[model samples]
Target: MKIDVEHVTKIYKDTKALDDVSFTLSEPKIYGLLGRNGAGKTTFMEILSGHILASDGEVLIDGENPFDNQRLTESICLIKEGDNFKKDLKIKNVLRIYAYFYPTWDQELADELIREYNLNPNAKVKALSKGMASALGIIVGLASKAPITIFDEPYIGLDAAARKTFYDILLEEYQAEQRTIIFSTHLIDEVSLMFEEVLILQDGKLVMQQQADALRDNAYAVSGATKDVETFIEDKEVIQSKQLAGMMTAYVYGNMEQAKSAGLTAEGIPIQELMIYLTENKGA
Candidate 1:
């Protein structure tokens, strides 16, 4: 399935959540949707799932608009941190209700996830801790097997071990299903490897979208003597710079070898650092 956002914009009273954002996903791949607080990441996903109408422009799934269309809406599953389940309902009942809603829901997968997450079917939703609630969302998202499965910061309150478990399960599920997966999270460095393509939004706009490896290759970090670093980045575009006691590290966007040739040590910048540099003050 393909998703195309053409001149998409979302406004809420005095604020514009999305400012004519535009992009396209031409194939089924893992996409990392990234942005800072109130940067329109959630709003963008809402538009894709047809949960809310865009203020202007359109979002198309395979050449057709998804607004109020049950066929397309059902095919896209958007899971978030706080999935509103009936507080008094037991875990089993919750899964049963979800099974009825999603045509492609897998009973076996649901059962497996319950055991994997160590969730009791008899326990009411209100009794579970925050992490357990996140686990339930993960189960529904993976077991639904929708063509476009979206996870928006779905692991809140999850410990490191539990978060790692979720990531492993997600990769395994995607491998077996071969569906379009959209994962939005602030933990970029840990989950960056999970993405084939990365889309970054800043201040309600699509700033950058590129293949993960290709994007990394286009940026580098230079460090050494302050004078040497400054000389190395004299003509290049410096995304970010920090100085302390005559030592400087400047994250620059350009050829990696160019900095190395100028007698400065070059290191690979992680996705999180790249994001910070790109959206620090004056955004990319």
Candidate 2:
């Protein structure tokens, strides 16, 4: 399931949610769609999921347009943030409906997750707690077994333990059943390791897309005497810099070997911190 987004754009009155965004994602890998709030992450997901049409350009799934294409839509499952079901439906009923719609849905997996999460299948969706609701959504998303599974901040209200469970289960499922997973979330550090590739969006534009390991290797925190640190990054892209007392730490984006030769102590920067620096300061 290869997704090719070409020159896609979305306009909402005065706001340009997506500005000519483009990317190509090959199948059977986890992709992290990362960005700050209102950076077009959600918009991109919506377009790909066939929930919204792009104002310009196109989005294709294996060379076919996905918007309103039932065949394509059936193969792509998007777990958005917040409630997506009718309030009156019971938890079990919701899963049953989804199972009917998605031909590839695994009932056995769904049953296992239902038991693991301890969800009351008889309980109405409106009566469930936030965490329980999120768990249910995750179960549906994973059990659907769509070729392209997208989770947009799926653990919004989950606790640490519950989130860990979700991550573990997701990975296990992925290994057992190869699929394309696009995870968009602000919890970058928590899920960074699971991503094979990362796509970064900034202010409605696609800024960077690279292998997760390569991106992490390129991002580093270099610190030394203020003068030496500044000199070390003279011509490089410095994402962030701060002075604590007389010492300064600069987060520079480039090859680590370049900084090592300059005698600067380079430390790995957390993906979350890197995202903040890139999106907050316009890749400063």
Candidate 3:
């Protein structure tokens, strides 16, 4: 279930969604695909799931190309943003149809999830509330039991409680099934602990890919007097900085020891906040 993206690129008319991005993923691990809006995270997932073709280069699953390949498609389920289910179909009917299509579909899991989420199977897809619709999508994705499950913002309309439930259920299923999960999300802090590795995209390009813990350790936020912060960061790679009321906080992308020596209080920055800072000050 390893995924390999080599020099992959995608262009839409006047815009380039992906710019020769490349990465490799081993199976049986949770990966966090992180980025700001319009960072090509969605485009990368779409190419991997065979929903869209890469404008250049290749996307492969276990050495085989996944584009339009039925065998590979059946083993990879992608729950993308927005409602993709047929509006005319009932929730029960949709589940039934999916069960028939995927040989590895788990009926028991689907049934349990439906009840746990308090969803009415008889309700038409279009009739369900936004939260319920997202819940249904989650059920289908997990029950499909696809070896490679890619979830792109699957908790869009879910409340905080419901979203926590989804994460808990996902962890339970992954531990029991040992499947590869690629989660693309903006709620980085909520799900950061679950990710073994992280892939960060910036403006259609791969900015960084590394072990989650290692990446966090490599970067930090240092705060002190405005002048002190400036002097401290003079020789370092300051990813971002903010000053207010004579105090300054700067995100320095380097070793903590260096920051401490410069008389700055270096603290770990949460993944979500770090991403926002990075994407916002990408040019700085």
Candidate 4:
């Protein structure tokens, strides 16, 4: 599903959650929507999923507005961190409710996930553990088969092994049938490789949006003598830099080959480090 977010903004009382952010996701690829707390990641996801209306601007999925549009909404599925299903309902009943809502729901996949997660369908949502609850949410998201699937920190209490399982299953599902997956998670190192593109929001504004491979292939940390490093990066797009004693280390978003040829020790910057450098309060 193609998404066009044009100057989208959301205000809550006195605070602006999203500030005229605009971007276009025009392919069926897994995108990593990242930011620290209060960066408007959840707000953007809510608007995209049709749960809420934007205060200004619009969120378009395949050229159609998402808010209050049942046809558009049925094609989108968003699974948040917690409190997804009703506490009084059993797992099976919850699945039934979701099946009714989603025309493309796959019961077989849901049943398989229930067995894999070792979840008893008869158990009520109130009785399940935190990890179990997260697993149920994951099952619903994967089985919904929506063209657009958004996961906002979907693994809250799952262990490392369980989270790994979810990642593996998600990739397998994506490979079998390509779909647009917007994954918002703090576990950057764990899933950064899965992201084709990355969007970063900071302080209610869109700060960065770039291809994952481009960031990995182009962003570099070059360190050497202060004067030499400074001269080398004088014309480069420096994301961040540090100078200590007679040595300097500069994180740049250009030309790894050029840095290497300049005799500076160049290493690729990890996505997590890049995001931190880009979104951190520079004045602080």
Cα RMSD to native, each candidate? 1.8, 1.5, 1.9, 1.1
Per-residue alpha-carbon lDDT of model 4 for 177-261, expressed as tens digits? 9999999999999999999999999988998999999999999899999999999988988888899999999999888989889
Candidate 4 segments exceeding 4 Å error: none
Q: Which candidate, 2 or 4, would have the higher TM-score against the true structure?
A: 4
Best-matching candidate per TM-score: 4
lDDT of 1 by residue, 1-284 (tens): 99999999999999999999999999989999998988899999999998999999999999988889999988998988795588999999999988988899999989998999999999999999999999999999999899999999998888999999989988998888789999999999889999999998988998889899887887888999999898888898878888999999998878899888888889888888788777766635
Candidate 2 structure quality by residue, lDDT tens digits, 1-284: 88899999999999999999888997689999999899999999999999999999999989999887999999989998887788899998999999998999999999999998899999999998888889999999999999999999998789999999999999999999889999999888899999999888998998788888987788999988999998888898888788887899999889888777888799888787777777875433
Candidate 3 per-residue lDDT, tens place, 1-284, comes to 88889999999999999999988997679999999899999888888988889999999999988888999999988887767699999999999999987889999999999999999989999998888999999999999999999899998789999999999999999989888899999888899999988888888998778888876898889999999999988988877888999999998888888778877788987787777776774563
Q: Return the lDDT, model 1, position 217.
A: 88
Assess candidate 1 and give its TM-score to the true structure. Answer: 0.93
Model 2 clash number: 0
TM, every model = 0.93, 0.95, 0.92, 0.98
| lDDT score of residue 152 within candidate 4 | 97
lDDT of 1 at 262: 82
The local lDDT score (0 to 100) that residue 206 gets in candidate 2 is: 85
Residue 27, candidate 3: how far off, in angstroms?
Answer: 2.9
